[model samples]
Target: MPTFTALTTLADGEKARALAESMEEMDPTPDGVGVFEMEDGSGLWEVGGYFTEAPDEVALSLLAAAYGARPFAVSELPDTDWVAKVRRELVPVQAGRFFVYGSHDADKVPEDCVPLLIEAAMAFGTGHHGTTLGCLRALDRLMNAGIEARNVADIGCGTAVLAMAAAHVWPRPVLASDIDPVAVEVAEANAAVNGLSEKVICVEAAGFDHPTLAAAAPFDLVFANILKGPLIDLAPSMAESTAKGGHVILSGLLVEQAEEVIAVYSAAGYSLAHREDIVDWSTLTMRRE
Candidate 1:
């Protein structure tokens, strides 16, 4: 069974979303449709759809033109075991004392390093992306600096990797939450696989909205590895949820967007303590004032 994909970009997010919705009505309707803002600071939104059969290119072109977007680029993707391929290609990643790898790479885990097992099927926060890796490194640095957090929360935790990392270093239970239920499920599964199921609690919540998160307020350390817009929107809530003098680790921002994010966090009474740029992404560690 072959899969097909059609992708296009536009400057307007609303238009991109509308286009994605419209793609559902097309012949050979897409199995999935997604609209997301480009994280490159380009102010563009990408609209994409996955189809079981080849999509009509002429219809896609017409739809793109209607929305004033770039012509849709359609591609046929041959059926392949993507999870197996990811397992083979994604080697273990070492960020400070934390080592992230899949079970296939179990032999590569070092004796002295803290190991986090994230399977290739759940690939979002497998320490392969710069944002996740940056957060782990930031946590490692904080630990090295004699900062021990009693309560920690991993906001927008994709695979609970950050939460597990925090639990590994600290004795307290860590809270991990994601807006998507599937991610929360994946996070819980990852926690169990890493043998930190009791230490890391996975919940489905938008930001700090759940009862579990509310009861665990004033976190000593918080990790928000989501994109720029959500990070900005989360500043006030994050500040309110964090304890005074607590630490916040943020990533999923472009180098150019870091200063704006810093300014927002500063207004929320946070000062940048450290910043690292890994390729095009910028990660910042801040202390709440």
Candidate 2:
């Protein structure tokens, strides 16, 4: 069966959400509708829907016009085994001391590296993306510097790879949280796959809001590989959650956005210790004063 997708973008989030809500009433209703803020600092929101049957272009055009959005770009997507395609295309990624691979590539893991098994699926962060890779390398750098953390948290953890990495090195229970329930589920599953289920606890929460995260406050280290806006919003909570002289490794930022993020964290009493630029993304390591 073929699937169809209709996408449009608008400047206003409220308008975008309204369009997404209205999509539910259309003929040949969408199987799923989503409204998301674009991460490029453009302040635009994207409204998209997936349909089992081809969506009505007239309806989409009318909705776009009503919302002052760009004309919907509708596309037909052939039914393909995306997971299988991902497995074939995603080779093992080595970042510092961490070796991330899917089960299919298990034979490639080196004896000296810390192996993290993350299947290529719906969740993000498999250590292939520069953001995830940079965080792993930053963690490795801390380990190499003789820094030992007994308590750790991975906020916005996608696959819990970083949390597992910390657990692998320190043998301590690490808290991993994500706003998306699916990501949290994936994180927990990945932890189990990596045999770090006991060492890494997964939770679904936005930033540090959950009771699990709050109870485990003043963490010795925290890894947040989320974007600049959330990273900035998380500065105060991160500062409060981190122990004095504790470390925080952050990524999911464009190279140009790093300075603003650095400034925010600096104002929150953190000093930049190290920075790595992997392609267009920048990863930062900072210490709480």
lDDT of each: 0.94, 0.92
Count clashing residue pairs per candidate: 0, 0
User: Roughly what TM-score does model 2 have, to 2 decimal places?
Assistant: 0.95
Give a tens-digit lDDT track for model 2, residues 1-289. Answer: 8999999999998888899999999999999999887878788999999999999999999999998999999999989988999999889999988999988898999999999888877436888899999999999999999999999999999889999999999977999999988889888899887888888999999999999999989998999999888899999999999999999999999998999999999999999999999999999999999
What are the RMSDs of all candidates, in order?
1.4, 1.5
* Model 1 lowest lDDT segment of ten: 34-43
lDDT tens digits by residue: candidate 1, 1-289: 9999999999998899999988999998999999999876688999999999989998999999999999998999988999988988889999999999988989989999999998989887788888898999999999999999999999999999999999998999999999999899999999998899999999899999999999999998999999999999999999999999999999989888999999999999999999999988889999999
Q: Candidate 1, overall lDDT?
A: 0.94
